[model samples]
Target: MAEPTQNDAHLLIVDDDERIRTLLQQFLTRNGFWTTAARDAAHARKLLAGLDFDLIVLDVMMPGDDGITFTKELRTHLQTPILLLTAKGESSDRISGLEAGADDYLPKPFEPKELLLRINAILRRVPQNDEIIEKPKVLHLGDIHYDIDRGEMWEGDNLIRLTATEVALMRIFSASPGEPVSRSKLVEDLGRDRGQAQERAIDVQITRLRRKIEADPKQPRYLQTVRGSGYMLAPD
Candidate 1:
């Protein structure tokens, strides 16, 4: 499979503020990404049902089903990368958004160039098809199988969906299957700023990922905690 070029990447921008949404759409389109705008969560959902996007730009505050809630819902199936926009700049607020499964968060009043950089950074973290030069390796976890080269998880013939962050985590774990990856290291490798909040967010993402990989997430067998070391992927 060939990787999509920057010009071929599609982005969805969801904001209640029409002016802001329009401006962002125009700005991103001008910068080479295919941009689509939604007035709110409902509209965004409708668009999502019909169109596939490489990334989503979602605003935190909205009339109904706020960004955090919507992000959680989206993670149930969609793996598209999400970059949240929020008026609140507090670390707690940012952590909450991440806990809800957002790929990244950008505080409001941010420069357009900064947003572009953040978007690019997040997209770059995603595994590209061309990056797979080695022979494909499949990790067995009970009935589940993870393809390292394709960055896909499968339970028999049914493919399980993984969020962009989950895909990134899988690549890191598969690189060193038996070794522990420190939470701090996971945060840094994910291209996030180093902080306790980001580490906690990584923990949340790990938990979410376990739900997909483990038959019983409460007692994870493959993706295991390594006491003070961090987490390890013990494939069968």
Candidate 2:
């Protein structure tokens, strides 16, 4: 919007089609984003190892390793935001993409404008690290302390590792501590389009988060569900 700034956030574009890759590179460059093109997952992986990317635009229908499978594998270590491109528009396909840990998904044959909007939306949603803050914001839940500004969780002196989705959810909960955040709100906060499947997916992430923060996830104390309302994060 604001000329996208010369900050020139690095972007990785992974697709099998040569024409599409070239077109996307041109379009993104014109909008002030630095982009690299990869023909497939292997090429993308190689480039990923060499360069750091602010975001990744991946095609889900690659010949060898499909984007969904690759996304699941990437979730093991990388917390980089991924926007998936796919031709399939079925609900099941969309759910699969989200379940695989994609930050967002855009169906193929999409307008360049839409792609631009989605990219900006995701960039805006990235968590802010508190390393530079003079006074960091921390939420205390029992023995676990959540560093809001850094998107991190700690147990006394020890730090915990969280998946990308978990970090996103924590960011949302931290933003409005002690308030009830609806399932739909969590879906939107996680960069997911609203729907039953996305809501269900949020439930799964919440369960995982509870396991990390609660002494007994089945009987969550800090993360409690408000019947018919949604989930609330109660900190001490």
Candidate 3:
């Protein structure tokens, strides 16, 4: 795929290291992005208060306000894309970054090319979010109301928590309401890449989602599986 011209997309890089910040600003600018640099989260916040950015590249480790806490607080009001840079080989740290609302995570010492690819992939995913938010309105299944905008399913006044996988599946199905989404397509959409095992896992999630939203689990109304096509959500 040809890289989209990022001439209009502004990226904010937040890191305490002056050398890294300068290098990335130059490299990303050469690659077609408009770039801005900040010394840390505090500086990034100041810049953000004054200007809007297409995305933010934040380093996980910092002296005062770390990336995780900053991301968590920022996500309260902002849905902008965030990519976390952390120490290499820290899978737990990467997971924490995602939990704190980061769109993606790249360990330190990564190739600049790899970062560019990740940024493109995340930008593609961002559009999918916009499309979902613009449609479905909100699915009313029995007593539950699923907000496609927030990836949140609420029952009456209570908020029902969903695992990451479940949320991903819901977004995919919600996007094509009244249409059957094949299991293979769901696997690809979820970014699971787990062969058949992940497909089965999706089945488990469907069962759980049905129990929460259906009047009878055995005979689901909202979340239903097509004989061989996969799952279709017929939301009312």
What lDDT score belongs to each candidate, Candidate 1 first? Answer: 0.88, 0.82, 0.78
lDDT of 2 by residue, 199-232 (tens): 9868866876787899999999999999988999
**Best model per TM-score:** 1
What is the TM-score of candidate 3? 0.66
87 in model 1: Cα distance from truth in Å?
Answer: 3.5
Model 2 misplaced stretches (Cα beyond 4 Å): 1-6, 128-134, 155-168, 187-220
Model 3 residue 16 CA deviation in Å:
0.9
TM-score of each: 0.87, 0.81, 0.66
Q: How would you encode candidate 1's per-residue C-alpha lDDT over 99-211 as one tens digit per residue?
A: 78898889899988878878887898887867853687999999999988788899999999887888899999999999999999998888777888678878888988898
The regions of model 1 sitting more than 4 angstroms off are 1-8, 89-96
For 1-236, candidate 3 gives per-residue lDDT tens digits of: 44674435789999999999999999888888899999998888899999998888999998789999998888767767888899998766776776666766788899988788777655555544334444447888867888887888898888875544456667788878999999888767755444665476466657766766788989988988899999999988
In model 1, where is the ten-residue run with the lowest total lDDT?
A: 1-10
